[model samples]
Each structure stands twice: as C-alpha cells, then as structure tokens.
Target: MNWRPGCDLAVLHLRARLMRALRAFMDQRNILEVETPLLIRAANYDLNVQNILCQDESTDPRPLALHSSPELFMKRLLAAGTGPIWQLCKVFRKGEQGSYHNPEFTMLEWYRPGMDVQG
Candidate 1:
C-alpha cells in the first residue's frame, strides 16, 4: 500500500502563505484575531446543521458538541465590548459527506461591530 499525504508540500506552503496574508489583512484593518473553544457545552440549534458529539470519559460527563461555527462565542465577545474580531478555526458537522462538503473543515469567521448592510 502506498503511504503519502493527500496534499503536497507546495500546496501546504501555499495554504500557509494564504493564511498569513489573511491575518495580515485583518490586522491592518484593526480587527483582533481570536480563538474560541472547538468543543462547546452546547451545540448549535440550527436545524439544518448537525453537531458532532464528543464522548470523553476523562472529561465532564455531560456531552460536548463540536462547534459548527464560532458565531456564538464571537457574539459574546462583541457583547463584552470587544471590537471587530476574526477567527480561523476548525468546525465540525455531522451527516455531511461529499467532495465539496467535509465533516470537519477550517472556517474563517469574523464579526464587525456596528456594521450593517448599508454601513
């Protein structure tokens, strides 16, 4: 059996460069980069999205759900007076299988306070 990574080194390097560029762009706009929990006590209530439950004996007995998005946590930060913020994190979704859709994927989410459609 052949053993090799799906992504090549060149692709990895390009991805890293792209991420760096994104961070730089956000920083230039005075947007803070933040990180939130991947596993949360509660899952998203969106009916269209399915949350993946984590079962760990060593941790709390209560089920932990993998966050489908950082929107909730980021909103909390916004309520706490945090200005524009952005996050690059891994999100999980269950019952999704396809070439374009993945069970787990990296997502870039951001929140800009006081900005609306007509801003």
Candidate 2:
C-alpha cells in the first residue's frame, strides 16, 4: 500500500504528541514558541546545506533563499532579549530525495539562554 496518504495522519499524531510534550517541557522552564521568516537574502553557507532556490516577484537574480535554519535570526532575537524560543518550520535544501529525506523538510529547533547544546 502507498504510504503517502497515511503520512498526514501520522504527522498529526506525532506532531501532537511531540508538541504537547515539548510545550509542557518548555512551559515548565519558561520558554516561548516563536515564528521566523521563511525567506532570506542569504542562507547559511554551511557546506553541509545545499540550498533549494526560489525567485521573487521582482525577478531578482539573487532570489531569496529558503531558510536553511532559523538559528541565525533566532540568535539575533536572543541577543535582543527574547527569552527561550522554539520553532517548527519547513526548510529547504537541494539534492536530497528519499523515503526518509526530502528536498525540503520540517525542522524543530529551540534555544534556551544559559544552556548549551549539551543541555
């Protein structure tokens, strides 16, 4: 059986459980959910990320890059005094396609002040 149709339901169930758990986990510690821009003038140049490209209405040759990660902008927020923030967003990358991989994928990222990746 094709699994694509079931993906939506699976996503809902998983997202619900994950979101519920995370919200409680973060709430207990005073973190906030946040939204970030989906487009960017430039993207993370990390060698690991191959960017998926898009064009704008102005037809700018340097079309806005789909955000690879909101990490950079989110850092700016942290610097500007926003408390801990978490986000779930769709980010794009080029040249990846598989049963478990897509050219674009959902990413869950969160940041807490005074906590490192080890935390």
Candidate 3:
C-alpha cells in the first residue's frame, strides 16, 4: 500500500528526533552548523560517481551539476579558516540508486582543520 507523505507520520517523527539528537551532539562538541549550496558548477570527477546536471538561466545558461557531497566547498572553507563546521543537507547523485541508496538524499558532512584521520 502506497501511503501519502503525511500518512507516513512515523518517518517524519523519526527524522525530527534524529535531527535534534545530531544537533545536540554537535553543540556539545562545539561544532558549528552550516549550510551549503546543493548546485555546483563543476561535477565531481571520480571513477564511479556520476552527477546530475541541469540548465538554468539564474547562474549560468549551461548545465550545472548537482553536488554529490559538500566536500569540495567544505575544504575550501577549511582553507579559508572556517574551522569545525558541519552541514546537514540534501545531495544528488546520478545512477546510484539501490536497495539501500537513493539518487537524492540528506547528507551530513563536516570538516575539522588541523585534524587528520589518524587523530
């Protein structure tokens, strides 16, 4: 049975709870929440990842790619000294749907300056 969006109320409730929990966790760690653009000019050029592109007159007449992750821009912010920032936003990918994956989904990304994976 296909339920309308509002009919699926449990999912919404779960999402809200998760969001609040994440924010509190970040706040405890003194990490700042940020927002980034979903649309980007350049597509990520990895081997398997494909990007969705769209033509728009607002930014450019040419096709613009939807960002798969906020990694690139986040790194730029890190370089510019915006330290310890995290973002929870929607990202888009092309040809990546599966039983556990979707083309469009919410992503949580963060960057900490002067910190490496080993640390």
Candidate 4:
C-alpha cells in the first residue's frame, strides 16, 4: 500500500497559491462561493460524458451518480434567485483515463444571473 502523495510539496504549494488567487478574483467581483452535492439522483446525459454510479445499494433503492458537473444544481440555485455564484468542487467521470484526463478532477464553475454569451 503506497501512502505517499501523488505530487510533491512544490506542486501542492503552487495549487494552494492558484486557489487563493482564484478566490481573491471572485471575491473582488462579489461572486459568492457555494458548494453543491457530489452525488446526485440524476446523472448528466451529455453525449461524451459518462457518470460513475454509487455501489452502496443498501443506502437507497435508486442508484445515485457522481456528478460530472455542478451545472444542474447550480442552475437550481440560480432559478431560486441566488445572485452570481461560483463553485470549486470535485467531479467524477467514468472510464476516463489518460495522461491528460483522469476519472476525477476539480471543476470551477460560475453563473452570473444576467450575463450572456457575448459578455
């Protein structure tokens, strides 16, 4: 059982610095940081995305899927009149493994109520 970290201390420090900078940038724009559930009842049905299913059937009769993106839940918040919001969370996808792609990754998503594509 290998217990060492996947990356070195310098990499960890760099990640921490990046996260701080991102948070600072968002704070300056008044974007609230929010957290949503990782496991949800419905899976994303996007053509190229596959969801990872939870194995613990004993907990719930219906299967739960690890969210590939926080879009759905974030949209719900937006519909409920929550102002501009941003989220930094972990997302999971099934059967994705490569040098540049992993089964799990951190995702940063944001929604501004009145912003359009051009903006």
Candidate 5:
C-alpha cells in the first residue's frame, strides 16, 4: 500500500499563495474575516443537500448536523450589526464524493449587507 498525502509540496505552496492573495484582496476591500460554528443543531432543508450528522455527547446526545455553508450564520451576524464579513472554512456534506466533489472540503462564504449582485 502506498502511504502518501493527497497534496504535494508544490500544490501546498500554490494553495498558500492563493490564500494569501485572497486575504490581501479582502483586506483591500475592507471585508472582515469571521468564523462560524461548523457543528450545528439545525440542518439545511434542501432535498439535494445531504448533511453529515454527528453525535453531540454534551447536549441532548442526539445527532448534530454539520454545516454545509456559513451562509445562515453569517446572515445572523449581519443582522447583529457585524457589517460585511467573509469566511474561509471547511464544510461537510454527505454523498458528494467524486473527482470535483468531496464529503468534506474548504468553502469560502462571503456576505455583504447592502450589496446586490450588480454592486
């Protein structure tokens, strides 16, 4: 069996560079970086979206759903007067494993309170 990481040195370097550039661009635009909870109690209701449920021992001992996106929580932040914010974090989804799809992957979510698609 070949034991090797999926990512190599060159790819890792490129990813770092891309992340740095993204952060720089966001900073230039005055967008704040924020983090939200990955483990959530409520799952998205979309039929096409599958949530990876995990057991929470401390609480009700019921299955807690992993977040598919930071959209809902970020909207809450906006309502609470956080202004424009963006997050680069990992999200979990079930039954999406393939060449372009992974059960768990990095997701970039951005929210601007007053901006529309054109703006």
Candidate 6:
C-alpha cells in the first residue's frame, strides 16, 4: 500500500527556525546551548507518546533501547553540572504512520533547571 509522506525534515527545519527565536530569547537572558543524547535507557511512561522499543542487536541490552526523549537523562545532567538545556532530535514511535504521522519523527525538548514546566 502506498502512503502519504510527511516532510519530517521540513518539520525539523521549521522547528529549528522557530527555536531560533526562543534561542534569542534565552541568549538575551544569558542561557547557554547544550546537547543531550538521542538514545538512552529510561523514559517516562506518559500519555502523549507511544514508544517503539529498540534493542542493540550486537550489544545484548548493553545500551538497551532508543530513547523516547532525553528528559530523564537531561534532568540528571541538570542535577550534575549543566543548567537550562535544550535538545532537538529524531525519535521513534511504536504504532503510528501517516502524513501527520511517522513511525519515527523529530522532537524538541528543553528544560529549565530552576523553573517548572509552567515557565
């Protein structure tokens, strides 16, 4: 069956372009840019996402699975040494496909160390 292809790359690029405004906003406040992992071990069991599980064929769960987001790990970074970081990358979903849907798609995630989600 043929399916409609969404421009996820366009979505990613648009996302980056949009974030430039936010980055300027952050930069005005002296916030620094940081990068977290695209793959990680643990993830939130949340409602917005249905995740695809990926195993390292050669590693035998050494790294385990593809991350839903770098949220948990990024938060750990905040706890350790970094502060107020943002990340953008591709992510996988368990059972989704269409023009507005892709099995794997891009995401942008950010966190403020001192501020809550409302901020």
lDDT winner: 4
**lDDT for model 2:** 0.82
What are the Cα lDDT values of the candidates?
Answer: 0.90, 0.82, 0.84, 0.90, 0.89, 0.70
lDDT of candidate 4 at residue 19, scale 0 to 100: 97
What's the C-alpha lDDT at position 101 in model 2? 86
Residues 5-113, model 6: lDDT tens digits: 6566889789788878878887776665667666656654566876666678676654445666667767788888776677767777667788788777777777776
lDDT of 1 by residue, 17-106 (tens): 999999899999999999998888874667889999988869678888998989899999999999999999999999887978999999
TM-scores for all predictions: 0.91, 0.78, 0.85, 0.90, 0.90, 0.62
- Leading candidate by TM-score: 1
The number of clashing residue pairs in model 1 is 0
lDDT score for residue 43 of model 2? 51
Predicted structure 5: clash tally: 0
The weakest ten consecutive residues by lDDT in model 5 span 40-49
lDDT tens digits by residue: candidate 3, 1-119: 75556447788899899999999998988888988777887747555789988888996787788988888888788788877999999988899899988999988998777779973
Pairing residues by index, what is the TM-score of model 4? 0.90
Model 6: worst 10 consecutive residues (lDDT sum): 61-70
Q: Give the TM-score of candidate 3.
A: 0.85
Steric clash pairs (candidate 4): none
Cα lDDT tens digits for candidate 4, 40-91: 8874666689999886777778888899999988999999988999999999
Instruction: Report the candidate with higher lDDT, 1 versus 4.
Output: 4
The all-Cα superposition gives candidate 6 an RMSD in Å to the true structure of 4.4
In model 2, where is the ten-residue run with the lowest total lDDT?
A: 1-10
Error of 3 at 87 (Å): 0.8
Tell me the lDDT of candidate 5. Answer: 0.89
Question: lDDT rank, highest first?
Answer: 4, 1, 5, 3, 2, 6
